[model samples]
Target: MKRLGVLLISLSVIACQSEKKTTGQTDSTNAGTTSSSLTYKYDSLQVFSKTTTAIDKGKADTAYAKIVYPIFSNEQLNQLVEKKAIDAAGDVDSEKPKTYKEMAASFVEGFDSVNGEPDMGQPGAWFLDDQTKVLVSQPDYLCLEHSNVSYAGGAHPNSAMVFWNFDPKTLKEITLESLIKEGGLPELNAIAEKIFRKNEKLSPTASLKDSYFFEKDTFSLNRNFTITKEGLKFLYNPYEIKAYAYGSTELLIPFSELKALAKPNTLLSPTP
Candidate 1:
């Protein structure tokens, strides 16, 4: 089941301000004689700052950040999620940030340092909005999806989406290799290419050289995928396999089609 929505309340002070919000939920399910449950919570951290000169001139030379991430009952899982969330929020400094607050503060501080000088003639405000949500939670696997959008005086904003699958019991990241049998990627890629071609309305023998960005115009599956009730859904973020104008692409391959490739007793196994 899905979690509750976040309640946002912004507070302002002088030229810089910070705020936070939190929401949570619990879910349960039954299998024959056994029962299972999971509890998930989310918190949002936001920070905003603007250059004094821009503030005086009524122009916007600002830096802002907002991150919504999960808080799990398991400490190790929490740490892993936090680190990945911070990385997704654009932690480009030499020293990595340990927490959301540090990540946001460093973002604003970098803006201040660069725009603090007089007559900097900055173009526009910079922002990073990163959010993580539960996509699927089961007894064996839990998947979290992260969506991000940001801009720093560019012609257009940049966006990305990523999925993180975890072993619920071990709290460790799950890889596509573990889900598929040995020497199965070739067959899987063939299946995905057929679906992709149909989805894009490209002919069977059409060339991808000039129209797409795949290496040597070859089609392959990326690791950015999540588990769904019907199938495995893969995502190709903007500029991943095509130009930004084309936006993202999604391909859903049903479990029935993957019966031969999927390993036994894994998340990809078809439910009885």
Candidate 2:
């Protein structure tokens, strides 16, 4: 009777310890699983924010309201967004191997020279000032005058064209090394000079001789970069006034005057 009682007591002790261990493990696991909805809500909000769907500017009315609403609504709940950011401008070309070449986009996309330079179809001119600032106003006529970067490119390693304006005018050029020492636009200025020289050499009309126009300008507002006027030229299509450089000449003819040069009715076929 004594031996059986001893055995029974030992078995009871082992069972109690095992039960205690299992209870402890269960509590720990349940505690780990238990979490506030706040954490889940925050993670969900962050995921929503990172998703970006760009909208085309023209289709603002149809897509704008529906697209942006989700983002604003999600953020208002967590409200812990540290920062928002923007990627680079222009198209993301998948075909292009990732490169700085992305910067080479033309400032004026789809140049339709056929439009006759905007408001000057009758006969107009454009040129550089003595100071070589480009002004595109009719000498006497009133209209908006403006200049925009037409093209830019990264042609070589460590070489890039930040802007190529005005159909690339030609002029004489100096050595890049010398200009650099003179604290010049060693990169952009040198490129412009090259363009001028190239254009001069290629022009079939010798009268369109090469020239140089350069100036250093701090642009408006932020004035981050001091621009150098590396190239400027004069073009005279004499329906209007234009800004141009020295030795600039043009044969100007108004609509009334052009009528004398070539009779339109004789040369052009009348559409039926």
How many angstroms is residue 110 displaced in model 1 relative to the true structure, after the best TM-score fit?
2.3
lDDT of each: 0.74, 0.21
- Candidate 1, 117-158: lDDT as tens digits: 544344667778888887778788888899989775557888
lDDT of 1 at 171: 73
lDDT of 2 by residue, 1-272 (tens): 11333334433343222111112222321222111211111011000111122235632110000000001122332121111100122223333212111111111111112222343222211111100111221211111111211111122111111111211111111122221323334333334334434544633233322232222321111111111222122232211121222322222112232122322332111223
Model 2 Cα RMSD, 1 decimal: 32.1
User: Clash pairs of candidate 2?
Assistant: 127-243, 128-243, 128-244, 139-241, 170-196, 171-196, 171-211, 214-229, 215-229, 238-252
In candidate 1, position 167 carries an lDDT of 79
TM-score of each: 0.83, 0.14
Best by TM-score: 1
Model 2, position 178: C-alpha lDDT score: 22
Cα distance off (Å), candidate 2, residue 94: 19
